[model samples]
Structure formats: C-alpha cells, structure tokens
Target: MLATTIYEQGDHRWIMFGRDPDKAEGIIDTNQYLVISGEEAILLDPGGIELFAPMLSAVLKYVPADQIRYLFASHQDPDIISSLGLWDQALPNASLYSPWLWEGFIRHFGMERIRYCAIPDEGLNLTVGRIQLQFVPAHYLHSSGNFHVYDPKAKILMSGDVGAALEPGEPPLWVENMSQHSAHMKTFHQRWMPSNEAKDHWLRRVRQLDIDIMAPQHGRLFKQAHVDEFFNWFEQLSVGIALR
Candidate 1:
C-alpha cells in the first residue's frame, strides 16, 4: 500500500500520498483532496480505481467514508475522477459536487448514480459549519472547465496542477526544499500552459487572491512568504525563465 502524510493548518487538512514520484513524461501523480465543512466533508479528485483503497484508508484517518457528504473535481480528467464510481458504491449517500461543465464525462463513470451540480458563473461558496469555501477560476491554466478551490478561513488554496511538480519520492510534501521543488515547478509551467498569453493571464489573476498555504496537486505545500515567492517565480517562468 502507498503511504500518505497528513498535512494540516488549523481546520484545513489534506492527506497526500504517492502515485508517480517522477511524474513520468506526460504522466502525473494523481492527488486527492478533502475540504471539511462542519460535520460534512467535500472531497476533491477521487483518482483511479486502484487508488480507492489507499485513498479511502487515508481519508478515514480524519473522517469516515460515510461521513463524506460531497465530492468535487476540478475537471473530468480520467486521473481526477475515475475512482468516483468507487466512492459512489462505497458511500451511497455522499453527493458529488463537480464543475457542471464536465457533468456528462463524470456521469459516464458514475452512470446514473452520479448526481452533479454545475459550476456557477459567480463561483460557489460551501459552508460546513464554521469553515467556508470559495471556488476560483483557473480559466486557461490547465483546461477550460478546470478551476481551483480556496478556503478564505484557512488561507489555503487547493490548486489542481496549477503549481504541480514531478516530485517523486519527496518527503513531507511541504515546500521543505523550495530550490529543488522550484526546478520541477518551472518544468511543469513550461508544459502545462498552452500559450504565453494564457500563462500571463493566469499569473496576473492569481496574484489578486490572498494566499497563505498553496496546496498543489503535486510536490510540497507552500505556506506564507514562500507562497508569495512562488507567484513571483511563476511570473518569471511564464515569461520563459529557465528553472533547472
């Protein structure tokens, strides 16, 4: 079984483990996230069928599968939502919350079992007791339907692949070694964006958000000043700075 580490900043918590440490060429290490609200929880990106056991095992550390009330995906990439069917089978009562943009694709997995909600034009806010969630438009960062999630209360952003790294075998998923992680981040930016214009657009827009903890799909979680530096580095990378 793949091992995972639990990372938390107050009420905001995430459990990340392994899939592809090196990230391969076009391959990526699938990441799963959970955003807790009151007694209810919203999960993000359920990943593959093979990952179900490990993912479920990791999530149970914090809350029971039956306790999960919602599941959300940034988009409907196979790696992001395949295991959702498993979650539906495992936790029958939990509702799936996804970007309505890709509901058809997601429904293919859950079949009739998948109930969905569209991403709002003005974005959405989910409250689970005291915790609050805000959806940010990723626009062109990855895919048209893709979006990122932010927690204003915790200052944590669950950025899906926007700040990813091929950090295979990296321990502690926290910007523990920024220099090395920066190298991977640079390479990711190069291949992840479609055009310089889109890259520039994402950089400028993301800067307006108040971010403290950057919980990317891969690599480490960046907190505080490092979060600022990451945006600066991303701006440079978007303009063609060589990271490695």
Candidate 2:
C-alpha cells in the first residue's frame, strides 16, 4: 500500500492510501483517506477485511491508534467499511459516522466498541479539534444514502464514489488530462450511478463549494482545473443508460 500526503497546512493534513501493488488479484482497487486536525484524526472508507492489516499499519505511521477519533463511511458498501470489526478493536472509543439509513445494516459488520454517529438525510457539520467538516448529502449518486465530506480549510471534497474510475494496476495519483480521464470514469458512472436527477442534484450542490481537489474512492484525484472539468463533464453525462 502507498501512503501519500495529498494536502498539508498548519495542523491539518490529508493523506491518501492506495495503489497497493500486492493487493489481491480479483479485488477492486480502493483508496482510503485519513484526515488529521491537531491531535484528532478520522479515517474515510477504511476498506475491506483483506486490507485491514496493511491499512492499519500504514495509518499508524502518521497517527497513533488512539488518535483516530472517528471513522467515516460514505455508505454501507463492504469495500467502504468492512474493516469495522478490526477498527472496533483498534480504536475502542472512536465513533463511526455514516448515513442514518444504513446504521442497522452496517452494524452487522461489527460494533462492539465504536459508537455510531448517524448522519441525517440533509447531512451535518462535524468538528474535529478546530477544523469543521461538512457532511454533504449525495444521495442516490449510487447509494440510497450517500454523503461526501467537504473540508473548507483544505478545499477538498472527499467525493466517495461520485468520481470513481476503473483502471488496471497502479495509476498516477492525480488526473492530468480531462479527455483521457473521462474514458476511465464514463462507463462506471453510467452503470453504477443510477439516477440522472440525483446526479444533477449532487453536481449542483458540489458546484456551490470552493473545491480545490475532488478525491474519489477508486480513481485518480482531480485538482483545481481538472475538478471543474470533471464537474462540467459529469453534469452533461447521461447516467442510468445501461438498461437502454
């Protein structure tokens, strides 16, 4: 697993972990993020069971296990938070932030120690130390109750699956060309993201924010210019076309 610091300023930092060359052959590549503010930290989409050991090892290098005060799951997908059981044991007092709709279902993974912080459908603001994080509603972009985290300080929007791309092997961390990257993202969005109305709604909401980086769970990150380009392209995309 590769751990790269994508953003850092003052006491806040964002680290992205992905592109594990040793990852299992059949497992889809996934990116996990860690956000740190002062002494508190949060893990985003901690990943599946197979990745738990490496993920934890990678995370401990920057922040101690006890400093992980929270875990954010964009949705209830196994790839998103299946490491809940291990995390439960590792950070006994940390809280899990996720959509209220999937609390019961996600708990099946494990919840013996960590408390669940259920986010409302309209989303909410959470504070870690001095930094305030916004949980923005992104419902039906793919999941029934999905949310993306927006950090005003870092100007980063942790977009979950909204901008995900499918690619073989390890790819560069950030998108350099909009036209070339579109090919990687197009089919995934068309097939996985089911509703055009929802897609439009999410895009409009995201456009209102001052985003410097658009970080997805499965593909290259989009920075500055690429962020706007992706938003423009996705806004015009025709999703839910697979059935036709």
**What is the number of backbone collisions in each predicted candidate, taken in the order shown?**
6, 0
TM-score of 1: 0.83
| Candidate 1 weakest lDDT stretch, 10 residues | 16-25
Candidate 2 lDDT, 2-84, residue by residue in tens? 99999999889999999877788889999999999999999999999889999999999999999999999999999999989
lDDT (10s digit) by residue, model 1, range 11-82: 555555555443345655666777665567778776766677777877787787766877778877787888
TM per candidate comes to 0.83, 0.99
Question: How well does candidate 2 match the true structure in TM-score terms?
Answer: 0.99
lDDT of each: 0.70, 0.94
Clashing pairs in 1: 21-168, 37-128, 38-128, 100-118, 100-119, 173-220
Which ranges of candidate 1 are over 4 A from the true structure?
1-27, 239-244
